[model samples]
Target: LSPSTGHRSIRTSSKPRPAKPCDPKSPCCRRSLTIDLDQSNNALDFVIYPRQFDIGECIGSCDTSGSSLQYTQAKNDQQKNKPHAAYNLVFLHHHGRNNNSLAATRNHRADKESSRCCSFSRTGGLELTYTTTVNGPIIKKYIPNMTVESCRCGLPATIQQV
Candidate 1:
């Protein structure tokens, strides 16, 4: 009878489990932006030319000479007297894992504030491209036309993206 008890134990097998659910707040499940820079097969020299005069109220200035630089007209009459130029500006933000962290949340707010203020005070123009992702599925893509204007007043009169 003891031997029968040992041999009569029940055994059952279960199907393999499915993949674990993705966390809504997980950084691993988030989307990211990819930037690709294509330079022709040529060795290029790089240089940053400083502004000879104050470039409105903004901290940066137009790169006077470069392969990737350009100039747009001032948005207003007051800005026409200043030197006009354009350059690529790269903004890098490092947000840690916590979605509620200050860097993650406040970066866009700060950029909005700066853009509003600079639009009012600056004479020169700038165009930027970058990527950001949030939990929401909403995606926004903006490609502004080449702007040429006097920066004193009014938005870019000739705003058209090409």
Candidate 2:
């Protein structure tokens, strides 16, 4: 969230990271962000920020798609916004990756512009590919009693204490 006005995916022309051993399939684990959302109604509003703490490194630095981590970063090397590791999609999970049910959700402050979903709850979380660094304003549509599942590297799996 740098440049003061960063609300979308920003691309940069930086160099690629050199070949390193840390460069494996980047076999990462499942990292989840648990939020204390108490919506008495039937649904709740959710906001997922990129990185909430100093993940140090290797958090998103590896890939299993047979692709190497970018030599250069898409965003500035400011820890949170760093795109050394591609930011994957955030999935709206139910209990523990089962089917779904329930409401809708949205990213950022644009709630009115969000759409609705039925049957199951699955929202496309903030995904920053190698090309794009950070793209806020994601239309996260999910019901209540849900969580986020993202493919990430480093530290097995770290639950982001939101």
lDDT of each: 0.24, 0.28
Q: Which ten residues in a row have the lowest lDDT in candidate 1?
A: 88-97
Off by over 4 Å in 1: 1-84, 88-104, 119-147, 150-162
Encode model 2's per-residue lDDT on 1-162: one tens digit a residue: 457677643322121112133324444332333223242232333334222311122333332232322312311242454332223222222222442234322331332212111111121223222211245445423222122223343212333311
lDDT of 1: 0.24
Model 2 deviation from the true structure expressed as Cα RMSD, one decimal place: 20.5
Writing each residue's lDDT as its tens digit, candidate 1 over 1-162 gives 248566533212111112233344331111111121232122211111111112122212222231211123222321442232222111101111224666646765643322221122112222233233334333333323212212222211222212
Evaluate model 1: give its TM-score.
0.17
What's the CA RMSD of model 1 in angstroms? 25.0
